[model samples]
Target chain A: MISFFKKDFLVHWRDRKEIIISLISPLVIIAVIGIALPGWVENPTKTLQIKVALVNADDEQAAMQEFRDSLAARSLPDDELLDIEQQLEQLSPIRMLKQVFQAEHVKEIVSMEELGNDDALQQLQEERIAAVVTIPDGFTLAALNKMVWNDGEGTALRIIAEKASLQVGVLNDIIDGYVQKLNVQSAFHHLLGADAGAAAIASDDYSGIGGREMVDGVETVTSFQYYALAISIVFALLLSVTMASKAITEKRERTFQRILLTGSQPFHYLMGKMSAAFCLSILQLSIIILISHFALNIFPGRSLLFWLGVSAVLVLLSLCVGALVVLFTALVFRLHDETANGIAFIFSLIAGTIGGSFVPIYILPDWLRSAGEWTPNGLSLAVLLQWIQTETVADLSVPLVKLAVFAIATIGLASWCFPRRGRI
Target chain B: MLEAMELRKVFKGRTAVDDVSLFLDQGESVGLLGPNGAGKSTTISMISSLLTPNSGDVRLNGVSIVSKPQFIRQVLGVVPQEIALYEELSAYENLKFFGSIYRLKGKQLEAKIQELLEMVGLRDRQKELIKTYSGGMKRRINIAAALLHDPQIVIMDEPTVGIDPQSRNHILETVRLLNREKGTTVLYTSHYMEEVEQLCSRVYIMDHGRIIASGTTEELRRILSGEDTLLLKLDKPNKDLANVLRSLAPIRHVEETDNGLKLIIAKHSSLLSQIVQTAESHQVEIINIHVHTPSLEDVFLHLTGRTLRD
Candidate 1:
């Protein structure tokens, strides 16, 4: 077994063309894609700057006074009226809308300018701004009345744009989410009681609505990191085909028959090819990552524990590649044709395509993306991306187990497909 | 001793070997002689346990190896017709790997590799990659790889095909030394009759997936002893002269050669004058005429009615 392994390793190592192709091809692709399509991999909104005209017609103080007068007219108890006033002060719809727009993340992508209704419309028509957001008169009073009494028709925030664009779509979603939250808070108040509703409105969770919170200091994945890992995995998958191609040569040359005559077991021969692919995959991935990190800082300032996690993932991914090599080798011997390499190549290409190696998982259709996550490379890329961000050891468990299962299942299938004694 | 009993092999509805049976005694050098499509290689494959016969069993020392191939694999070394070696690796590396697979290791493997390389006359070029070597050099190394384990039996299938004379002579000499000095049983197969005649004490003549004849070289020669081979070199083409010779009573078979006509005739028959008279009557000049005892080539031609190369 060791002899077979050593021979396979030496054969691959000595083939300068194959080695160069395995290592250099991925690095070139990663560099090119990373430089060419950073925004696609990174935050899509980073390159989009949406300009909006804000028309604030409702006066906050007047709306509050009107709400108080209406409450007094109803002859409600002073304590309940005071509590309602307090809730109104904290949950002013106009003020909250302003805060949502003023959020740092929101401000990064959207620029809002206050203008009169006429001027805002004019700007929108001229395409100087992406859209016009209008807070109609009596909005706050109407909103409060709807929340407390559920008697009056609710006021709606209106947005006018010349055409439906990404900016307008983003603006619409943001406002829609905000209004839904407000309505939810009102429902909670009515269902649970005054104190519960006020508490929900006073939580201030809505203040950071525009930005995502950092959980446990997890960082965002950059384009460099994504392509670095993705392309490396794609190339590593090709290594299995490369190893199988060598097996084809061995069979064509009758070296495999010679080995059999020496009393070497077929299992040992397959394991030798698998071990070679495993080692080469690890080396190929490590080199790609190291160079990418040094040249572009793909994984900057990652902890030792983080690297250890990465190593664990790398090892499992390599094993999966090794198992694929076995399958390809078995196919080569069974089919006794060069088409085995082509079959392995097509398999790798499909896996890479569906596994998010060529594109981000978010862009794929929901079904394909889900399937992609199960692919070894796709799963590894996702896990590595998560590891880069979350650094959570627990997140590694399911993917690691899945990868191991994939490896074992593939090896079992390959063993079954392998040619039996005298068949070769 | 190794024996292949009534072996038959079919490939995709075509029979490659049919009821072929042969054997090798310990320390004996035997040759399987045939044309290109003969079942010699297939027979060797079955005996070496590389292939299983469809309806036969190969035995080693009275033990059936069909169900237990490992029995023969442990002591068998097969030098396939193709250069069955890693071209990207050096000769020494290839030998080391083959030796290691057979359980030789460390200094023992290294020494065995060195010994085989030297024996194949490739010691000085052992470090060079097999791909860099010439065809003959590669073949030499291929033979060396088979001997790395120092097995009790070595099966060579057309090992000297497509090589220069020097390499061919070297490979034959190596086989002779292994058989004579080391007492290694040999099962050699080739289409070249001279190679078999020079190296093998016994020979099996096969054709069309069956063994037509088998015996000592002298005994096989005796199959043609009842007749003699006549070589008549003609200066120019004459279908008439060949036809006339074929019609003669003493001549049993007449075959056209590149430069002449070969005739098989009854032993001690005096038909040369009649052939000369016939050729003169046809106005065909006889460049040379000679009569000799039948060799293996003549024997094959006599049996198959075709030359070995044909």
Candidate 2:
């Protein structure tokens, strides 16, 4: 084992490192973009997110008193009420929305870092806040009073920004409009003396019945994550292809062949190559981890399940890829001339692309995304990115199965086609 | 002992080697002779278990290598025709690696590497990368690498193909010494007749993919003992002039040369004037003419029609 490592390390140092830098492109890109932008990886969305503190002024009890409330106090809701009774009404959905402030967008997101200590609303200038909703503490009382007395100040929501970025304006406007409509509807119901009207709106019969309910009726359907997934898989594939070619070169250079002739079985030789590839892949994975964690800080806010899930899937995927590369590269050296190796390189590139290395599957045409999503690189990236963001394993099984199928196919390809005596 | 019995190999749609049989007794040295693409390397590959023959079998001692190639490779040392060793690695490292392959390690591996290095006269230069060495030096290390495991039967495929004469001679000498002192069986293959002539007691001559002739060196040479070879030096030896000289029956073969034509004849008197008269008719100038006894060149000419090298 020591000898194997020594030879592997020497080969890496003496030939590979000198011929080309190790994972230099990833390192450089991660560093340059990471340091220069400091947010590309962290903020996959290129635009600055609008960050505003929710200024609530409901005349409801304090948050501490609210936290103490127990739904258990209610008699187990009668089964009939559970189905159609005015129902156990829930807390109001907050006014969660974004507005494009154009020039003020960047300030809106970054300036909140100092907002906690302000003695005044001095920074509450129109340009300083992209959009503001001053929910007066009497908002709930006013609505109740207007409903009960049929006369009072109805709550108002307004925008403060002079300019609006398109999507931000639209999404934020939609969310704000939703909050207003819900308030009005609830106020209207209270006029009839029915306190549970909020439930009626939530269980809307005429909304986007295509899927799950959305906040403010805005659903975030996307293909962006698919593209990012491709990026990760493509890099891993690049590593695998090089490793496979390097295996043959390592053997021909008389590094491991000599060992094999000394009584080590053919299996031992194969194992050694496998071991080297494993170590290299794992090391590359670590570098990526470091670059992502510290350099980009992409995962700081990510849940532990998300991080674990992504790392686990990627590492295993890389391992199988490395193994397949080794077997094929050795086969190339032994039988076909150098041209086969060239062709393999092209295959790797093509696989990466079709697998969604460059094109994220989401934006791809529906048919293409479906095809790409099932591809090894494409699927692996898709699942991993989803895992990282959602921290859930809901759709991971398909990618895992696809990965296993790919590995098995590659192994069979190598075992059947690789020539035994090509090098000797 | 290493024996290759009626070995045949085919690739795709073509036969590479056909029914070739040969042997090297313990400590004995034999050579396979052929031009380029004569399947010499292929035969070596099969013998070393680097290849599987389509028909026939290779035996290390009396055991068939086809069924159990692992053990066969253990006792066989192979120095390929091309420089198979890594150029980036030092000669010493190459030897140690090959030594370890044969399961020689600790002091034994070191001593073995040192001894082989000394034998090849490359001990002082062993620490240098193989690429740093000259062609001859690389060739020497290549041969030494084969010896690291101290295999009972050592095989070389055109071992001295691209080496300086001095190193070539050193390799030849080393093979002789290993055979004499250690009783190592050697299967040497080469295109150069003289190298085979000097190192091998028996020679197998092959053309295309089949061995056409096989016997002791003397026995093979004796086939053309009745003939004599003549050197007819000419200022301008043209093909037309060669054709004219070739018209003489007793003159068997005529190869054009810058200075003259080298001819092989059955008898001296019957063809000398015919050759001179023919040269005059073609306006060809004869530089010098000398007659000598038959050598491997004549044996090849007699057998292949084209000179051994064409």
Error of 1 at B275 (Å): 4.2
Q: What are the lDDT scores of the predictions, listed in order?
A: 0.88, 0.64
Clashing residue pairs in candidate 2 (N, C-alpha, C atoms within 3 angstroms): A98-A172, A223-A362, A227-A360, A261-B101, A262-B101, A262-B102, A334-A422, B233-B260, B234-B259, B234-B260
**Candidate 2 residue lDDT tens string, A17-49:** 532444556555545543555433334334444
Give me the displacement of residue B106 in model 1, in angstroms: 2.7
Least lDDT summed over 10 consecutive residues: which range in candidate 1 chain A? A206-215
Angstrom error of the Cα, residue B58, model 1: value is 1.7
* Runs in model 1 lying further than 4 Å from the true structure: A43-218, B237-256, B265-284
lDDT of 2 at A176: 56
Candidate 1: tens digits of C-alpha lDDT, residues A199-305: 77666565444553456565888888888899899999989988888888888889999988878888999999889889989999999999999988777677899
